[model samples]
Target chain A: MKWDFTSVFANTDALLAGAAGTLRIFAICLVLGLSLGLVVGLGRYARTWWFYLPATAFVEFFRNTPVLVQILWFYFALPMLLPFEISPLMAASLGISLNSAAFSAEIYRAGIQSIDRGQWDGARALGMRWAQAMRRIVLPQAIKRMLPALTNRAIEIFKMTTLASAVAYVELLQQGKLIASLNYNPIEAYTAVAVIFLVFLWPLVQFTYVLERRLKRDE
Target chain B: MAYQWDFTPVLANAPLLAQGLLNTLKVTGTSLVFGLALGLALALLRLSSRRTFAWPAGLVIEVFRTTPPLVQLFWFFFALPLLVGIEMTAFMAAVVTFSIQSAAFFAEVFRGGIVSIERGQWDGARAIGMNHGQALRRIVLPQAVKRMIPAFMERAIELMKTTTLVATISYADLLFAANEIAQKTFRPLETFTVAALIYFVVIFAFSLVARQFERRLAVSGESTVR
Candidate 1:
């Protein structure tokens, strides 16, 4: 079959809207996930057993299962579990955020652990409280060290958002699939979408590589 | 008000779920074996002296790595038949799609492992008159494989989760089975909850084992160096 790429262009407006939807989910999830990660990471990093135990359990549960299943669970099951209904978009965002949070927690834990013990001692010696030392000293360096890993998580979250398509959330991939089914030319349709994803992701991937190298140089 | 739970439907469909789990494992295991071989080849191709081999290999890895695996699965399951004029079962499409997609990632892991070897080791092998192939196979890979184990296991665990994507194409994997039973029984919550638990248990156990193996490997690796 001769591939006719022109057919994909017929629904350009829809595809663009879908791209925006994808970005919106990514943006929301990024903020929520990072905040959750910080909380969980701090909990796990703390000496107290109560905080550590729940944090560890949360991370393990989210990390171990597939995000696709999680999304499905949120979409179909959450309504049953909870008192209210959730839009498909909200479910997808929640699922992705919770999943990303688990990975991010690990990244944060590793980053916090990588900070020199002496640095902590120095902060304490300066008469700063524990919270102040963490915020004013340890977190800054840990955030720098964690930048590449966090960026990678961000990218993974972006990719996982495509699973929103399964929930009928009309993301870029879903819109492309709709177009393909309409046109009976999935090759052309999906090829264009793949190119769009490549174009979208290449810069972020490059940025991570550059950031990693720059951070290494400072060491 | 509290919600009432029902697991009777899920329990009755245990055999179907078991079959689906077997299918999921089959798809993941076969793809993993082939993917590892293809990934190692791509890694070598990327590192080859000849630009002819390296350039396209790089492009393939970049494209595959960057795109969502679901799109790849759709492309294979739906579009490829029209393009190639060859029909495929959903399982075949999944296996092929996953192998190709995973090769891109595993290639990176392999490359990282190979590059982690000290420069002197490569030079020492060359000094002993081992050709590139001999050195890679006999010396470098033996050492590199140890370093690669953790990454490889991580990828394998990832691939196990990924096998659920086959359900999108109507392949009756674990997720598909759960979805079917849920819809049939009008018990989506309980059915899905059971399915999620199964996945968590399987993957969690694998991760625990991998962590243990990795710890042991780290100790052994350190001791050997000492």
Candidate 2:
């Protein structure tokens, strides 16, 4: 078969649908990741032995290891440890979210720790409880510090969703693989996938730069 | 037929596990050297005097850095051979892909150090009649390298974890072995956990070494600066 470069985009509709699936996964995983990360990050900062020990273990294991293994474990082995059945996509989301949470927790812990002690005292003087003070004052401020790193990490997780191809999710990378199998044009199939990702990321790159500049000027 | 992890399978496969560990380190070691070399060249090119040189280098860095390593790995394994008509073995493909992909990141980090090596140092090197390359190798790189140790170690740990992605293309790295065990015994939990542990050990050891190197380099750098 002659090498074909334009065949993967033969059906624009299917490509768009695949892009939607990828973004959907991204949105779901990001929300789940931040929530889980919040708890882990607080645990790290609080230094409560219970939360600290477990959070440290969780963060270290996930951060130091490969997300691919985490995904495979969730899809292939995790459900067996439980009584309920889970779909592959759910499994992918859970694994990616958990792995990402580990990272976000580290970032959050660092971001929160970077805040000045003066802020905490001011909050206490304002008659706020520890929880209230953290929510209203500390978190917002820390999140600003965390945003740039978080943006970089978010881009990382977005790129990693391509690995969902392993557990048989039809995200963009897997979709491109399937297209390649059918059309026998791997370059166009994968290049089209790269182009699709570039479209998502190029804007994100600019947005991160703008956010950084905006944050810098505000500070 | 319920499944719970029994270590017997992993224990029995100890030799294979050792082989996997060695392979992971080999890939990491070789790629670090090769990636650093390519990355340095790219970093130099990006900071070159000519616009034509800088633009293409910047483009290459953006393309690889923004994209996923898995895509790059797959592209090289499945498409590059077809695109360029040269077949690579699975291991070769992994090294090539990782070195090329990681060079983008390595270059950026290196660029940070090179650009920050105090403008006076560059002037001094030029005053002594050193060309750009000599100035870099003799004066700029030594100073930049001292500060760059921390970043290099961090990137190394990242590269180690990235080796697992090569498993997707049937490369028998640690994760691929774990995948085989998972498939045969339906014990993905045990296999992957153990695999994760092996990676952690490799990474942690590297971290310890990196810390030592950092300390040593700090002493040398301080003396040299003085």
- Report lDDT per candidate: 0.89, 0.84
Weakest 10 consecutive residues, lDDT, candidate 1 chain B? B217-226
Please give, for residues B1-226, the per-residue lDDT of candidate 2 as tens digits: 5765587777777677778778888888889889999999999999988999999999999888888898888788888888888878888888998998878889988898888788999899999999978999999998887778788888888899899887888877788888887777666677777877888877777777876877787776542220
Candidate 2 achieves a global lDDT of 0.84
Deviating ranges (above 4 Å) for candidate 2: A1-3, A214-219, B1-4, B211-226
Q: Please provide TM-scores, in order, for all candidate models, with all chains considered together.
A: 0.97, 0.93
Query: Each model's DockQ?
Result: 0.81, 0.61
Off by over 4 Å in 1: B222-226
Error of 2 at B173 (Å): 0.8
> What CA RMSD would candidate 1 show?
1.9
- In candidate 2, list every pair of residues with a backbone clash: none
Residue-wise lDDT of candidate 1 within A1-219, one digit each (tens)?
Answer: 787877888789989998999899989999999899999999889899999999999999999998989998998887897889889899899899999889999999999999999999999999999999999999999999999999988988888888889889988999989999998888898888888888888899889989989997998
Structure candidate 1, residue pairs in collision: none
Lowest summed-lDDT stretch of 10 residues in model 2 chain B? Answer: B217-226
True contacts kept of 1: 0.69
The per-residue C-alpha lDDT of model 2 at residue B169 equals 87
- TM-score (C-alpha) between model 1 and the true structure: 0.97
